[model samples]
Target: MSSSRYLTNQFLIAMPGLEDPNFFHSVTYICEHNDNGALGLVINRPLEMQLGEIFQHINIEHADPDIRQIQVHLGGPVQQDRGFVLHEPLGDWEATLKVTDRIGVTSSIDILQAIAINEGPERTLVALGYAGWGAGQLEQEMADNAWLSGPADPEILFRTPDAERWRAAAASLGIDLDLLSGEAGHA
Candidate 1:
């Protein structure tokens, strides 16, 4: 809403005063943002389960020892039982949303299977569920100063630890979130 431009492939960092339990101190990676609606995944809320457990539940024998212990994340509140995989390289999957030239989201079982066998994209963030907003809903929220949109850094998605992602994403804008007041205006 700031300039009539969409926030596709951006990171929506929760403001200091965000009271919503689902979004407080959260960092969401916007996979698709446009005229109809927007869909994203919370990048920092890791669930109790790990990649190995998820693969087992789905009856897939995971072969990637390096990522077997990688914890899955709670992407958002909606579709809590469904799984989403945010990765790079825009590979051909049964169902996918190309977020940017370097990022893509896949919800297909095939992609999961590929990942279990170590044949998937080089980097992946396994998450359950996703965040969704109706047409103009996200823009309105931004207008009300509920969030801060910034460039999506793949490092935050793949490298940074979850406990620190919220602060790190906010810091990516050169503003220390800890120093911000609870009562903020437009971001």
Candidate 2:
């Protein structure tokens, strides 16, 4: 098999006809890719939960309404209850995963508090879970045309509207999303 490391920290844009309900029109950001497998976060799927709701559930006082209004995203299918904050690189944290030079994922309360205080990283998207693929599963999926890979764009991930993320990511690769077909089989 080829090395998965090459795809690390890349964007995996779902093909036009992806049948999987979970990944249909999904825009996933590959956080770690290696021989073991790949892990990523679905950046485009936002859950109904809001940051304020989460703060209330966790008993964390959210004094500022702005912080509470931040949308909570659906990170992935696994560990749906867990939280993953994809944010701009700033401040210290307990467990932080640097997704790129401009983006980082923090799973600590400190980051949350910083966000509540409006003193956190300038760009951030709070997710409720993360996507995971077993060994070689992602590579196989990519080979099968289930996804298109491209470089990560902080603006696309954090700034672009969720409704347009799929097209934007594909456009970054010079792909016209409408031209893509769902059928994975090729001649």
TM-score of each: 0.94, 0.93
Off by over 4 Å in 2: 1-5, 184-187
lDDT values for all models: 0.90, 0.85
Q: What residue runs in model 1 are displaced by over 4 Å at the alpha carbon?
A: 1-4
Give the TM-score comparing model 1 with the true structure, all chains together. 0.94
Candidate 2, 1-187: lDDT as tens digits: 7654467778999887787998999999988887788788999998887899988887877788888989899999999888988887745688888766767788898888778878888889899889999988987897898888989888898999999999999888888888767874321
Model 1 lowest lDDT segment of ten: 1-10
Q: Write the per-residue lDDT of candidate 1 for residues 48-161, one digit (tens) a residue.
A: 989888888889887768768978999999999999999988899999898877789999999988887778998999999999999999999998889999898999989999
Model 1 RMSD to the real structure?
A: 1.8
Local lDDT at 142 for model 1: 92
